[model samples]
Target: MKIAIIGAGGVGGYFGAKLVKAGHDVHFIARGEHLKAIQNNGLVVKSILGDFRVANLRATEKITEIDQPDLIILGVKAWQIKEIREDIRKVLHKDTVILPLQNGVLAADELSEKIDKRNVLGGLCRIISKIESPGVIHHIGVTPTIVFGELDKSITERISGIDRIFKSAGIESTISEDIEADVWRKFILICVSGLLAVSETTYGELRETKETRQLMIGLLNEIFLLSKKAGVKIESDFVGKAVAFIDTFPPSSTSSLTRDVWDQKPSEIEYQNGSVVKMGEKHGIETPINKFVYSCILPRELKARGLR
Candidate 1:
């Protein structure tokens, strides 16, 4: 497959390296020091599964420099999806597939708005990884996983082919029966991310503190209600499953959203918590807890974007 990875940070860098190692023609679109390091010395991936390096990488900062790709793994944040629409349109072929691996639930729909919906696939990834440095990707935890399917959840030739490619690279892969529902399932896990950013409670602290736990419940409940309003058909036990999964994390574990906010970097706040607020208004649902979280994070996010 001719693959172009849009944001070659942790997610793109790690997965793109695996594809390259599997002998796929892959190009990385990155910027600044990361681009320099990969071009000069290749990309290194440190993983518990196994560590490997890809020397003589095919890399460039512009998508236009890439040949028309068979597949483009959209690894940038949900918020940055809009920023890359024109670049993607310029290089896309009719048969080119776009898989969005953002954490948020709205990436597929958002991407399809700019491109043809037939070319967009509903996708999400499960992995804990980051750019350890300019040239290095460190896989910290989780079995790196990719769950994806057509928006309508039908099995097709390209879906199977993509599945084969991922498994060939030793990634845990699944083709969803109801990708919309699965996307919302993954979204439930993100509730704590922005909540922790606002509440500033450790996982242990959140579990022990009654007030914090109440706020967490409020956050999850709002999403569940909104999911129903949006007609996404999320499971009845959504909140319970979300809380159970959250409880399994270590005390010090914090989401990328919380960390990004603390680090004063632009984050997925608008698409994460802020999306809940926006969608609630769209669906005529009330989301006070989500609203509060989004409002609190907006000032910092604006400052980070230099919009404040």
Candidate 2:
């Protein structure tokens, strides 16, 4: 399959390397030092699954240079989806499929608004990875898995093709029966952990302090309520499930958003916690905890981007 990876960061870099190793014609779109490094030294993936390198990397910074792709994996930040929508469209064939793996609930809908709904797939990934260096991707956490499906959750030939592609590369993959619900489930996990990590430094601090733990529960409950109000059909006691997952985390663990904040980089605060606040207002649901977390993180996020 001819594939194009739109944002070759940690997610894109790692997955793209795997597909390339599987002998797929994958084109990577990246920028700055990362792109330069991949062009010069190829892409390196140091994964717990095992390490490998792709020396024959086809990488570029310009979207116009890419051929029409059968599939496009969006590995950009949530906030970056709309910004690159048209550029992505420019590289699409009529049947091109776009899968967004960013950490947010609205990725598919956001892309559907800008691109054709037929081309957008609801998707999420389970992995903890980052660019260890300019051209190097390090997979540090769970085995990478891609869970995706049509917005309506129908099993189609294209979806099966994608499943086969990932498995061929030794990447775990699944097609969710209800991708929308799955997306919300992931949103709850990330937002709760990310918000608490942003406010309290680490999961250890949040778990150790009863007050912060209560705040964490409040955040999850509020978001769950909003999801219910929005008619996402989430589990009845999702907060309990979320709290259980939190307890399993390593004490020193911090979310990707918290790590970005510590590194003074721009984050997905607006799409994560901030989205809960915005969606709650839309649905006439009160989300006080999400509002508080969003308010606290916004100023820091803006300052990190020099927009404060």
Q: Give the TM-score of candidate 1.
A: 0.94
**Residues 140-162, model 1: lDDT tens digits:** 76678899999987999999999
Looking at candidate 1, what is the lDDT of residue 268? 93
Per-residue error for 268 in candidate 2, Å, reads 0.7
lDDT of 2 by residue, 1-308 (tens): 89999888889999999999989999999999999999999999998788999986889998889889999999999999888888888878999999999898988888888799999999998777888889999887666889999999899999999999999988899988899999998898788746664576677788778888898888888888888888898879888988887787666667778777667789898889888888888999888888887888788889998997
For model 2, how big is the CA root-mean-square deviation?
A: 1.7
Stretch of 10 with least lDDT, candidate 1: 247-256
How does model 1 fare in lDDT?
0.87
List ranges where model 1 is wrong by over 4 Å. Answer: 201-205
* Range of the 10 consecutive residues with the lowest summed lDDT in candidate 2: 192-201
Candidate 2 residues lying further than 4 Å off, grouped into runs, are none
